[model samples]
Target: MADAREPVVVIGLGRFGTALALELAERGHEVLAVDRSDARVQALSGQLTQVVAADSTDIDALRQLGVQDFYRAVVAIGSELEPSILTTSLLVELEIEDIWAKAVSDHHGRILRRIGAHHVVFPEHEMGERVAHLLSGQLLDYMPIDTDFALAKIRPPHSAVGVPLAESRLRSRHGVTAVAVKREDGSFTYAGQDTVLSHDDTILIVGREADIERLVTRS
Candidate 1:
């Protein structure tokens, strides 16, 4: 179910790379999935537009596969820093519109960025941070908008229940804005001055990271 217009090359056939390719294919993007293993290529044959058994680090092989014409190339060789780096460099040299690489460490991320990768992702580190936030109990979900800003889903504490948003003075006191509130009946309303917070209400707030954290931890 791929769209002919958005062609993408995914280099590497590890779980992460394969999952990404399949997801893109499902989203209607033409995907060429490359792997060094014949078995892997065979396994993904019907799942992708093209499943090729070739080393992504091989520039000649890449050109032969017409990788240069891909709208985006993902170098997702997990744990293999050398091949990952070399493949990233090759994709840049081929002038692929966008190059995304997976890095095992901060140092590796820096190297990939320096070599002209459009973006480098540290999946393991990011997953760990997300898990830590979930385990903190107060936050139902936490998403960092930037280094300083965040959006969070938090449950209102007992003291704040039955109070109008204006009376709570959350904006001035906690420096956070309650953008939405989920009611007991499963309906959601945009937070307004007249909106009354009730017990067990799930609220979505956006503000500075520190302020959001304070609001979540407020008693």
Candidate 2:
């Protein structure tokens, strides 16, 4: 397993890159933020482990910054497609084990993947879809695990509130599995066949996105 404190290099100082860098730092990871603009580098100088004003596409600059030593890197140059692809390609060439790139469109994402980006993300598109899902249902939280699978948090439905998992027939009726439950006392526990849910409890269910949506709509 990768060390939890492994340093991460974030190229670009766009909104996505800045947010990712800050969040990583908040989670106790050492983040090296790089950007071409001096102002952008200075803005995060006090927050991240290190901040540099240098072009990521420059192999020499990257090597000088010790980016080759970092196991993970993120190319977040949105709106600047060429730089993003070039940065990702350089990381791949440097044998960075994990390379995540932000792509503005399908074509951009395809190129990033083809050039060896381990992960390609469309943050705007994903956030929009997530908000749409939350707006259309009573789901308290919705997290997509993959193309079809998702984990949903919701208040227990009337039919499930007073029954144990074995008797609730949730899987049989809704095609969803109750993975965990959060009691009224604000504690969470794994849900089992013998676990009974209270009306005020919250449940985390896992299933196909369609199935979870169906269950969410019912509640």
Candidate 3:
């Protein structure tokens, strides 16, 4: 077992996995990049701390490489359900403290969580929503608070500009609340009932997704 201080083990050398490993290694982490393909491992060998071509589903292979000693493990094989799940299970059995898995679908995400993955990310679905928000014109950024609620940074609609939160009745009429005002000058102000909105300012709003869509549509 190599010294395991501040180490991260990354399984799968696909685009997402390779990029993650590179970034972690760049941030001064001891990254062990694992993949079943020798070509994939060789491609990244010069960039990361270590690269190994080994099947992660094999528990003995993982044990030999001291996979359990790493503080975090990332299973980035989204499409390969079998290898991904098996690798996650092996990591769990080895008692890796933190496991982050990339999941292809909602069902896949649930299974990852059920098998002791600390977090599961749905990349394609999340990217689609983000792109939609960017194309919508009014919303600058969108972050999901829950299945039904979101936090949005948006440009104030023409109808909303020069209006105070009290008159806008955003909370009552739209079921949205202004959290903060980010001015064009790159300063932020805490929002209050009396805070007036401006066309140039970006406002952070928290509300149900439907209410947020309504606010944007009103623009």
- How would you encode candidate 1's per-residue C-alpha lDDT over 11-50 as one tens digit per residue? 9989889989999889888889999999999999988878
Q: Rate the local accuracy (lDDT) of all candidates.
A: 0.86, 0.90, 0.88
In candidate 3, the residue pairs with backbone N, CA or C atoms under 3 Å apart (3 or more residues apart, or in different chains) clash, namely none
Stretches of candidate 3 exceeding 4 Å from the true structure? 1-6, 185-194
The better candidate by lDDT, 1 or 2, is 2
Model 2 per-residue lDDT tens digits across residues 1-219 = 469788899999889999999999999998999999999888888888689999888999999999999999999898989999999999998999999999999999999999999999999987887788889868888887887898888988778877788899999999999999998878778999999888889999999989888877787
Residue by residue across 1-219, what tens digits does model 3's lDDT show?
A: 334447889999999999889888887888889999999988887788689999999999999998988878999999899999999999999999889999999899999999999989877787788778779877889987777899998987676678787888788878888899988888878988888888889999999999999989987
Candidate 3, which ten residues in sequence have the lowest lDDT sum? 1-10
RMSD of every candidate to native, in Å, equals: 3.1, 1.5, 3.5
Candidate 1 clashes: the total is 1
Task: Write the number of the candidate with greater lDDT, choosing between 2 and 3.
Answer: 2
Q: Which window of 10 residues has the lowest lDDT sum in candidate 1?
A: 1-10
- Using all chains and alpha carbons, the TM-scores for the candidates as numbered come to 0.86, 0.94, 0.84
